[model samples]
Target: MLLKRLQPMMFQARRNYVELMFQVMGRALQAISDVDEPTREEVRALPEGFLFEMQVMPNGPKLIVEHTGDGKLHFHGDTAPRPVDLSIQFKHMAHAFLVLSFQEKTSVAFANDRMLVDGDVSYAVRMTRVLNRLESFILPKLVAQRAVKEYPADIHLPEKLMSSARIYLKVATQFVETVRA
Candidate 1:
């Protein structure tokens, strides 16, 4: 009886958690692009005004990113944008929860057929690189080891610690600002 009652709430909680992560990911990408040259280079690989989305199927806790003409990626919250250049859609909210919660690495989830992506393969690859770079900057090495397929060996701990601090602060501030708005 309790299990049945809790199931819907659990699902909603996961959905909310995924939404929060999406917002954080969006901000982290923007913050990294400004401070990390390599991340900026990856963002530059997308053509001006290109848009890509990562979403959960049926309904959503979606996040869309458009490569602005100014050579940066802009996060469009959960609002759908027209003519998306690329899309990655998880088959279920559970799958989205698994990947977004860092319980499963994205590449592993994709390899396991948990999601479907529609768009240019090259752009997807570029986006993956961008995500990987951002993940390295935003996540702790321990969490990142699980979130990303391989934690970067070359990342200096002190540098990564500093970068993670900045990214977390940026995302937290952005969250506060969004709440205020």
Candidate 2:
């Protein structure tokens, strides 16, 4: 009886954490795309005006990033615009929590059938590359290993540290502004 009572609460907690992670990750992607040239290139590789969306199925937290005309990505928080060009939908909040928390690497989660991709799967591959790059930039090496399929190459420790600090600072500022709004 007690276990049953705790299940819903645990799921709710996971849901909330996933929601928060989506917001922070949305900002992190924004900051990284602004500063990381490789990420920009990946965005440009997608179809012009591409809207890449990540969300949980059956009404869950979401984040959208659109490839704009200027060849850059624009962050849209939890609100997807019309005609999302590509969407990655997690099967459940637990699935999102595992992947977002880095307990399951993205490819691993996908292989394990934790998500559904709507729209052009090739576009999803392109966005996955972007996600991998962003994860490598923002996460510590040890942690990043669990989050990305391949650790980033040609990353000097000192340079990566400095870049990570700047990106984190930007994400933090974005978080604060979000709270104040």
Candidate 3:
């Protein structure tokens, strides 16, 4: 089965929701470099009152990240409704967020009912771009760091299963590459 190969890596995947959000936020902030200075400054200077409410689904926790207009980041949960400029929801874990940003197949994945996004369409589009940039630039570093921290040694797997898994990876990689090209 295709998932057999992925099973090994799955164990290595540490789905720390908090860390994932911070990684995305850090990368998104860095993506400001891709935009003009005034726009960047405006985003950076967003009011201290500005907040983003992220409602994670399927029993995951909800969080609010406060932007201090001065480019500082803070998070709170007990705050009242503060007229957020954007709110987003995703059913999958944050790793899927990174995957969606990297793969154009995400739209197809969503259409195929593998993922769901809800919120303002325009804001979501902009957010997608920001996430794309962040994923492109930041995920490699995060993955490497996480690999070392979470799994620093080789894992042994049954030889037959390992061979099958390698085949699956090859096919999946080719599919992704074809879709990308």
Candidate 4:
């Protein structure tokens, strides 16, 4: 009887955490995608209306961003209104949080069966590259190295400093936008 009484509360707590996870991730992705010119170019080059979704399992929270060929990403307030071109689904909240916290790399999570990919393989690969770029900008060099397949050899001190400054400012701006909306 006591277990049953606590079940709903536990579920609600989990739901809240998942929703927060998606919201934070959405802002971070927006920040990274907003400032990087190369990443913006890559997003623009994607097929029009391409939607990418990263979701937690069992119909909890999801973050959906679309590439509209306008050099900017459209982050959906709700779920993806249109069909998803590529979906990376985490097996559970734990797995999703692990990746979000940078304890597990995205590639490592996928390779270890912690995630499911549903869509075109080639497009997913491209999307992985884009995600890697974002991770590089946001994560420290040690963490980013684990998260990405390879670090760019040409990222020198001046460029790294500039990129870090832009990424930090963008993240702050996105946080404000998220809070305001």
Q: Top model by lDDT, which number?
A: 2
**In angstroms, how far off is 90's CA in candidate 3?**
2.3
lDDT of 2 by residue, 1-181 (tens): 9999999999999988998888888888888777778788878787777888899998999998888744477779988767788889999888999999999999999999999999988888888988888888788889999999999787778878877888899889988887899
Across 101-155, the per-residue lDDT of candidate 4 in tens digits comes to 6788888898899999999888788778777887776667898887777877766
Write candidate 1's Cα lDDT for 98-146 as tens digits.
9888899999999999999899989988898889878877777788889
Off by over 4 Å in 1: none
Q: Considering summed lDDT, which 10 consecutive residues are worst modelled in model 3?
A: 147-156
Model 3 clashing residue pairs (backbone): 46-69
Q: In what order do the candidates fall by lDDT, top score first? A: 2, 1, 4, 3
Question: Residue 38 of model 4: what lDDT?
Answer: 79
Question: What TM-score would candidate 1 get against the native?
Answer: 0.93
For model 3, residues 74-112, the per-residue Cα lDDT tens digits are 445424366666665556555344443444234444555
Would you list the clashing residue pairs of candidate 1? none
The regions of model 2 sitting more than 4 angstroms off are: none
| Cα deviation of 112, candidate 4, in Å | 1.1
| Candidate 4 deviant stretches above 4 angstroms | 1-18
Judged by lDDT against the true structure, how good is candidate 3? 0.45
**Candidate 1: worst-modelled 10 consecutive residues by lDDT:** 30-39
